[model samples]
Target chain A: MDRNFPQELLETIQKADRAGAQAVIDAWAVGRPFHRVIPELLSPTLETFGRLWASGKDGVSLAEGYVAAKVAEDVLSRVLLDASGDGTPRPSSKGPVLVGNVEDDFHPLGRKMVAAFLRADGWEVHDLGVDVGPAQFVDRAEETGARVIGASAMMFTTAKNVAKLREEIDRRGLGNRVQLAVGGAVFKLRPELVAAFGGDGTAASALEASALFARLARRASEARGEVPA
Target chain B: MNSLERVLAALQNRSSDRPALLLNAGLYGARLTGAALKDHYRDPEVFAEGQIAVREAFQPDLLVSPFALAGLGAAFGSRLSESSRRPPNVAAFAADSAEAALRLPLPDVDSHPQVGYLRDSIRILAKRYAGEVPVIGLLASPLDLPPLIIGLEAWFDALLFQPETARALLDHLTPFFVALGRAMLHDGATALALTANLANRSILPAPVVERLGRPSLEQALAEIPGPVILHHGGCPLLPHLADFKGLPNTVGYVVDAGEDLAAARAALGPGPLLLGNLPGPTLGDLSPEDIGALCDRALSRRAADLQFILATCGADIPLDTPADRLEAIADRVHRAGRVEA
Candidate 1:
């Protein structure tokens, strides 16, 4: 679908009017499917919000991006509930995905957005929050039988920790069983860092995280000679 | 000229024999001075000892306190943690919401233990240097304090959703910074450095910085004494350069490595000292010879500017930076000074 984000909704979000923004999204969703709204309207709005936020332009604040993401998350949860009422199996019944910020990094908004997107895409997501160590990630993955682990680092200093986490994951012999994905502002700044840190995959934004996780899952299944579920 | 004279001359926009080097030499100096980072941060005496060793090693123009933002946040009841390698940081935020953050008790700058420790550290450093070298007291700016007081994400949220609450929190915290600046000055600090890590395009949009950050900083700057330097490692200060220049007491701007130095110089004019543009990330990776070459390049680029000071953009020198590489940069600057003489 050719999705044009409503400028009015974007303005409402920028104004910090969460209720008005939600009302606008709800109105738009009256005739549209939740899938269409998420990928087309919501995702594009978030991308635009980020761009404007970073542009240091008028009427944009880091807080507006936070508010927009929160509103989108609420809408996503509601959409998922509504979709589940139609007597269809939830899309995320495939396997659990664990997401978190790497050690020594307190920035978790990226990881939280990735988790929300994955949950919206019908995957069971386990969010480990920010400043998470390698052992915690591995321990949670083992307990939940997570098929994919997503790690994020916001700075070059903390991005170095992702490499350590990757080593710990390999040392534990979970390298093949669990796909390790890494991203954040640092990843975008240094594109080669994904491979440098021994990550299975990387995505530029939370919007692309679901697809990246799916591709990694497919590759993991192929490596195991198992039919793609 | 002595190290102090060289730095003051550069700041005065006069022709010093060479560019003044304001090396951070804080964290790396701790390791070199035989003071563990953990010990240096915990005890004022160890911090003073580390600062003295760093001054002896580099003989740089400025002597910044070994401690950074840990004391300010801790004074306000935020939890702090120390590690062997890294500088201490807020272990946990004091509050989650703007109301709760504003409700945090204002620290008694005179008697607060952390503030007292910082004051003692400054006093010892000043006495040891005996006014030969200038000591800088560091304080986080209003915009930067939110993240330390509350969490980063929540603070950003407050900036967007509840700006009034955010402003009130800053208003409440502004006195503490002013008091800290006054006390440090009384304790013999020659100047104060305010670190505004959040006032950048990467963290907040420019309008928000103008609306929220500028006023709080102006209020604090109005009360603090002159010769205050503004430090923000986030590049692209071009947008907020005007805001900084408008501050009454600001005498210099520290441009991070990736920022446009020419743009900053153009905006700031020749009056305010422009220090830095050195990349901190490559400090550990580059060889001593490479570091000297880098210094030569930076000096040659701004040969005509009389107000430039060679310095690192970041507050803390990277832990792994080789002592020889740092010495090389200082050696290059000193050699340049000798040639000019």
Candidate 2:
């Protein structure tokens, strides 16, 4: 809440004193939606860390950064898990969503991020994890009666798997039923490539992605007459 | 001018009769050395062998550190499958705990077996070469490192769901790198090379990179006392180039495959040396003469004022790629300037 907090965090990051920044995350982090945390706390913290890490300040190694990210994930998970344990009523008007890293695409960070955002935003989210083939993605989505399907690929070679997933979905006639969303480094490099693969939508950022899926789900619900738009 | 001296002169921005002959052998595969390096994982002999091979053959002006960034995720706690010939691939993380990542004490570079092997490699190379060649050490950036500790899925989830914590993790990770660079320099490394494949134009979005990946890279590059080479292995990566201007001591950049060398020369301005864009594997089994011609085309197209070196993207040089091919490249650089004369 102090005006100097973000500045101090930035300074600490510049000094490569991650404990100082972790102290900030400890202070400001609450089990809140990503949108709320991103603009104020998450955005500032990430912006500072990103800058400092690139600059090579105070001997920060990628291994150390990996440690810090794991730490942050623990803290966030704690908050979210605690809130869930409290049995407080979560808004449940939205339909379920299914997400997974596409086949041969071992990168799942993007998918995980979106799932977390959706969960915090009150959508029932299922993460199928990585190295999943196309049939599995659709099978899981269908079994869960999910309204949205989110897929991700971190590597360029594996991103091609998205097309296979799309083809299978069409062949199974699940294309119209499930709205497909894709994101990651591969999609970012080639924005137009997703359409050719038959993905319904793509998002550039986690926040944008969360919003995109929410909108898509709402549209799908409207088309099914399951809910008023 | 001799090959090494030509590179030196170009690095100093002095006029060179022609572009310096820069030879880079791309080293993937899982081999590493030493107990410190192999403590938690199977030490891929690739690290030691690559260093040895790169040193022996096509002794370039610089030795790019053995492939380590590809394995950072696994070192931090992800499971990785390795092969002798390919890059060690990491399976996604299951926990994705930001808190877990931050809890790790910064690894002392020499204490880590991998780092120890690396130190030994550099020491051996330096002691043997005696300043004849320079070694550029490699490491991952903050955004690049998260996926390893928490697994890719969980780390991404943290990025969206718990961004504050993710940023905190990056903040926590910075000092270890700074220490790593300092350690490498002390161990006889002449330059710091960040083979940030994640920063490739093909992977990370420009705005995201500018917002999250570049700043830390800039800070990291600044801390290295020797030259800094930012290896952007895939695509032009030009969109994010401007974010690098403030890096205090960067020596040059390893441009992506088939990038317009002239455009890269123009874009990078007159300051840094441009290393290469050899489409190593993508060119698909070309002759040494063919490879030499591509190198010539890249070097000659750039302005003489813009120092030029030659290299490949992130992949390792194929073993079948004959030594003569590399030699042919050297021969051409020597003869290239004379043709214009």
Q: In order, what DockQ does each candidate have?
A: 0.38, 0.08
TM-score of model number 1:
0.90
Over B1-341, each residue of candidate 1 has an lDDT whose tens digit, in order, gives: 77677778777767778888887766766777777776777677888887777777877888887546765777777787665656776767788777898888988988888788788888988888864888887777777777777777778777766788888888888887787788888898888877776666445655677787777778778998756888865444566687678686898888877566777889998788888877665477678888888788878777777788888765467777778878888798777752231
Runs in model 2 lying further than 4 Å from the true structure? A1-105, A109-229, B1-3, B15-18, B21-46, B55-59, B92-95, B151-164, B196-214, B233-235, B285-293, B318-331, B338-341
The global C-alpha lDDT for each of the candidates, from Candidate 1 onward, is: 0.75, 0.62
Looking at every candidate separately, what fraction of the true A–B Cα contacts under 8 Å does it contain? 0.22, 0.11
Model 2 lDDT, residue B113, Cα = 61
- Tens digit of per-residue lDDT, candidate 2, span B118-227: 56655655555454666666666666677666765455445434657767887887777777777878877777777654444334434445565667677666666777
Regions more than 4 Å wrong, model 1: A1-5, A11-17, A31-36, A47-64, A81-95, A120-122, A155-157, A184-193, A206-208, A227-229, B338-341
Clash counts for all predictions: 2, 73
Give model 1's docking category.
Answer: acceptable
Give the number of the best model, judged by lDDT. Answer: 1
Q: Residue by residue across A116-206, what tens digits does model 2's lDDT show?
A: 5566445678889877889998888879888788888765456668899989888888665678898876676568767867788887555
Specify the CAPRI tier of model 2: incorrect
Query: What's the CA RMSD of model 2 in angstroms?
Result: 9.7
- Model 2 TM: 0.59
